[model samples]
Target: MSTFEDLAELHIAAEKLLMVPAADEWLLRGSDRRLDEAKFRKVMVDLLSAVNRSVGITGFVELVRQVEATADPVTGKVSPAAGAVVLLALEQRIDDSVLEERISPIMVVLSRAALRSMNAERELIGLEPLAVLQKAVIPNEEILFREMFPELAVSVDGYMVTAVGSHAQAITPVLVNAANPASPMAIGPLQRQLRSQVADLTVKRATMIARTETARVYGETAKETQRTNGITRSRLATAGDPCPICMEEAARGFLSIDELKPIPLHPNCRCDWIPDVENWLPPMPEVVQA
Candidate 1:
């Protein structure tokens, strides 16, 4: 049976390869270019269906709302502006998934440790779904360790490593599913089911992209914690939250002023950095008051 460790490892690998560059290729083409509206709608519908299957009904509804809200009225299509908005939303969902992936490993490892230390099935009384969940999560860890520890370590790899290695191969299924051109399901419930699955997967795909970017940013080794010096950049910008580094209020500013940075912040940072040449300038140093 699979242990949480096995499942966690699988998740890590899955996270790494789940989103590919090609996943957003269609979205990118929607800008300025006159894309086939029929094709674009079809793509969105397929994407909705896939997300519904994996996540459920609520996810699909949310995705449809986002797509509708962001779609361009001018062309009856998704424009760069809409694409940008949806992409950020996609990024937020990914952030949640990343946290989920990191914590899941610990859960699996600890659960197995408990089971083995006790050595009795009855010791797991009232564990119910957790017991089953653990089994499903890490089916092969103990077996592999007993059967081949050193070899397994050599052959297999850490979660991040395996994830990076497998990401490209994993993209195909997502692409095929998201790009499916099938007619919408006839039944209402089935249609709902399809949308939920597609929405969930859409979010998952975003998370995968975030993970891959994170791995790329961190490289093979651990990254040192970066210290940022908050500097205000522009006064002619939006007044609410200023960019810490350059105090400007562009539409794509980070949530916290302290979080502001160049595009692709923290491997998975979906915050965009656009150049407002008219407003761009170095932040003035704070003067000490007497």
Candidate 2:
């Protein structure tokens, strides 16, 4: 049985193993060359592969075990079996929409950061940033997932294809506004910007994924327990951080099961939802005998 802290550490480790390296590799490639569509596609593919390999069904299963082992703070009871089912359902949701729900946004953010780094490089060199005429088309998710997790891929090649052309379209204006193509550009600032963006986005995306998945699994587990055991209320438990908002919310105490919501009060929120099975039923009103 793992503690909540143990579960957190596992998530952090997975992020470092998968997310950080992928982001760093992308930034490295982006910094090494001028914006080229071919290279960018290659890097994106590599990133997707890395992400897929880093955390698989096995990793998620371990997470489910950890979450189940940890006792609900309010009730001090662990519901491993129920939690397992909920986690599996969450996995299904991830499989159905991971590309659209998770990867695409991450790619867009990475692309934006790359463009910004290029512009910053141009500015440092006294040259205006180049206006982006067209954006790299984001590759098909099925294709990306095929080599790694073929079973998880919905189709081999043909499926609903969505391109990240809009992400490129949106960022071009920002680059055009900041760039001065007429002047000479330096390489140092651009390199620095790429590194910084990579580090920042890596942590941001990883934390978002971890926290979001955790919240989903926990919420589903709580709901399952409610349905199974007739439990009707839960409470929010924090990592005991000094964050004022979390503390204030924690002070508010237990809420009805229907009223309870997922954690992540903000980005990187480490709070957990603890089902209060023991005290779930509300007190009966006394009869008025006049």
Candidate 3:
């Protein structure tokens, strides 16, 4: 359990110490992957060339064909590009497990502090301190990854399409210039596109997952501790620039312990829970829900 002030502090620390930094790391790692732009461009070009005999035929005909793969409805042929993207992204992908590992350091510190908080509260209330902190179990990631890879492929395939269309417009000479390792043309825009999309979409998804999981950990841990001590209510604190939905949730002061976890109204929510403390909050002015 935490005071509202304590919850605010936790929320701030998680953002500064965990989410933004992790996003930057993921963006950079997922984009260049430690390779220089020229080298990375060459690598992608080579992969494309291998797939479709050469960059010329590949970028123009092959990419268009793949995009229009289901054009023949009766036969219903699968998109080859989709299949390729799935395999490539899977071969070098970061799923929930990787994200968990990335955020675990901060999570561990936060969870320990929470455990201590629960213990202190119990002692104050003349109850026994918890013997052990409950550990959150890692689910079967292989099955999860199997479900996720195709979704990632959908995005990566789009990025490939972007590379084909941007700057070069799938023309042979321009693409060949891009394929050249020294003084590459058209690759810079493609590289920027890859980095931009991954940073914007993938990083956002990862950040959402991170925050949601962290809130789950907080909620579950607090729920158990509160149940043990016969406490029944909690509060959610809004941090950063919150949406109207969040304002509404926050306005419902000292809600039931069941909703103790931060339930994000949308992705990248910055709301967090205070511990199961009763009637401590003054009434908040209600906001009209949309």
Candidate 4:
């Protein structure tokens, strides 16, 4: 089994590789570019605005806010995926709108990594174990990183286990002195505050992108496939009971006992479990915000 340190190293490497182009783009922002650059840059900004507005639900919105607070002001590093996508469009130098053209690739890389990782884990452990891991690991980040830095081939394997401890410490809020919405007269101040926060998010995005790409480029090989042909020798093992978190019956024929991997029994979950499983284990619990 892979260690968390091993996975963290890979993540760091991936980030570094993707960072170069992102940093370069930031440096070249006001420099010469054909009409193409101007057009796409506008599109990129629009897409980013849309992404912020539609970033999951309330929790995710708050998460973005927190990320922005700590992110570098100059780089706008709140979410690396944004930078990766922009870099991708810039590289193509395509005249098309960056958002329409780039969102798919970003989504594709994220989805593929997720499915492939789950499939591999399913074959190695049991379908239940894999499902639990899927709830835990979240391959989207790795995929986003790799796609932004295609030259750096990344695969999602042990990122979940490594991400758990870090995630615990990573949830600090990005404080913003948001203007009082009730005071309509403060509109200008509110806009300025929002702009600052948005800038922070941009930097965070760039940093994550760099880490993911670097890891993919110079990291250890991902498991080719835990099983052959995607066919498990045994049926997906089940718990024969309802999952505590979802309250849905655990599908029959999956692996894992109830106590060790109880709630949030699927992969990429937001819930908690007591004794976390190895590489693809569920999280311990969310910290209570003060």
Candidate 5:
């Protein structure tokens, strides 16, 4: 199973890969004399599309592997039927609905920031700031993942999966200097802020994907253990020194598999549950009478 640290590292790597181009574009557009509403919109759309594509391709592949590794052994044998079922369940659980719920608002904030940054750039160039327009269309999660990783396959009995990661977070609120008109707005500050926000968003999306996949894998693993090995309970384990809340929760001891919930008492949670299997062998029979 991929450790939480491993997952985080993957997110960081992928974010960096995508951020290079994003930063370049933001800088290029900031200096353009012809920058207008239409051009600004185009840049926002292009950035958003790149984010979706990078996360879908990089995050999804890692997530699928983590889930698959937990549910099935890596014995170098392919099981298309089983793999298909697993893929379907994961797709259903972590589909567009899930992505939209977590990422749509962030994207909105990003689009707005992008527009604001453009305006700041224009102001620095002795031009009036353009009014912000309606938000750009957020990329579709289904299309992103499907285009990147359309199918789940196995080769030589091992699942084929790719790995990637990077880091980012939410945008800080934009603070304007409304006290003076024609005061040169600093494009540098705005660009830096946008860059950080984009990086933050990348990390957030990747963490979310990992959390969902881990939960699904835990649930399925528990079910399988119970069915095949008569395991009925699971114990919670923390990856390192757990937080006060997780430590308190862990003190509760083992619980029935049905009663147990996946750990990550909060975001960036590094806890997991270990199953306890009961001995299923029958007792020896008493000696027969002569």
Candidate 6:
């Protein structure tokens, strides 16, 4: 079995190989070719399609098929035969929530990491630890360093894709700004700036995915630990001089287990709601107001 670090490294490697170089190549040489919003989006669709295909959701998709398959009420088993699948849907029931449980490749890796952290916290408090993901995919939004998004995008074909980290909104400006990007791209400021923006966008999206999983798991785990006579309050800890908003959030001091989540944590925000259990994780630099 692949460890969390292994999967994470694979994701990073895939991005570096598949997304960044191709995007930069296009930006440097192709952005000027009758550039327009629609065209740029098309380019994005192509790039993201390639990336998704490369990373693959093979394992996850297979799992989804098994979990979503209608189980026979009598035997409590499912057959792989096509006839059995048809009969299950027509005869047995299908779970609508099953589709939602399907996790992305990157998410599976990140969520596993979150479980590790959550267990670490539980171990500190002498409580039983969790081992499964019982939630939707979410990124660690509080991370300060990332190697990559605008937001989720749905193309005209009803397909949503992540273009490395570029978004529909950013495409317009990139369409305008990417003209005449420096050749021998490594030497040009605008080329670097454009590439940097994409990297920043990707980082935001990736962080959000990782943070969402980590925060949700941590918050829920914190609540669970509290049931075992653990700490009831949480402190909004920060690295240092956080932006105004985080400064304000920090002022709120201790919050209940229910109120412990500070998610949708602003970009550049390094604050995490630590269980006020003493000796929690160290504070991170607060996010500057966006």
- For candidate 4, lDDT tens digit of each residue in 84-109? 33234322332334334444443333
By descending lDDT, how would the candidates be arranged? 3, 2, 5, 6, 4, 1
**Residue-wise lDDT of candidate 6 within 152-245, one digit each (tens)?**
1011111222221223223223322322223222325644564565556555443222233323333344566564454667777764557887
Query: How many steric overlaps are in each model, in order?
Result: 30, 12, 0, 44, 22, 19
Native-to-model Cα distance after best TM-score fit, residue 108 in candidate 4, in Å: 8.6
lDDT of 1 at 203: 49
| Sliding window of 10 residues with minimal summed lDDT for model 5 | 152-161
Q: After superposition, how far is residue 20 of candidate 5 from its true place, in Å?
A: 32
Q: Per-residue lDDT for 1-290 in model 1, tens only?
A: 11212323323322322221233532443331232223323433333233324344344334444555444443334555544454454434433343234333332332343233222211222122224324523665444332322332332334322332122122222222332334223346555554454445444543322123323322111111111212222112222333453333344443433333433333333333222224333335579999
Off by over 4 Å in 4: 1-44, 52-102, 105-185, 212-214, 221-290
> How far is 240's C-alpha from truth in model 3 (Å)?
1.1
The residue-by-residue lDDT of candidate 3 on 16-39, one tens digit each, is 222211244445334322222233
lDDT at 161, model 4 = 21
**Per-residue error at 284 for model 5, in Å?**
20
Q: After superposition, how far is residue 112 of candidate 4 from its true place, in Å?
A: 16
Candidate 5 Cα lDDT to native? 0.39
Estimate the TM-score of every prediction: 0.21, 0.33, 0.38, 0.25, 0.33, 0.38
TM-score of 1: 0.21
List the candidate 2 regions with Cα displacement exceeding 4 Å.
1-45, 48-183, 186-196, 204-217, 230-232, 240-245, 262-268, 277-290
Report model 4's TM-score to 2 decimal places.
0.25
User: Higher-TM-score candidate among 2 and 3?
Assistant: 3
**Candidate 2 global TM-score:** 0.33
Better of 5 and 6 by TM-score: 6
* Model 3, residue 203: C-alpha shift (Å): 7.2
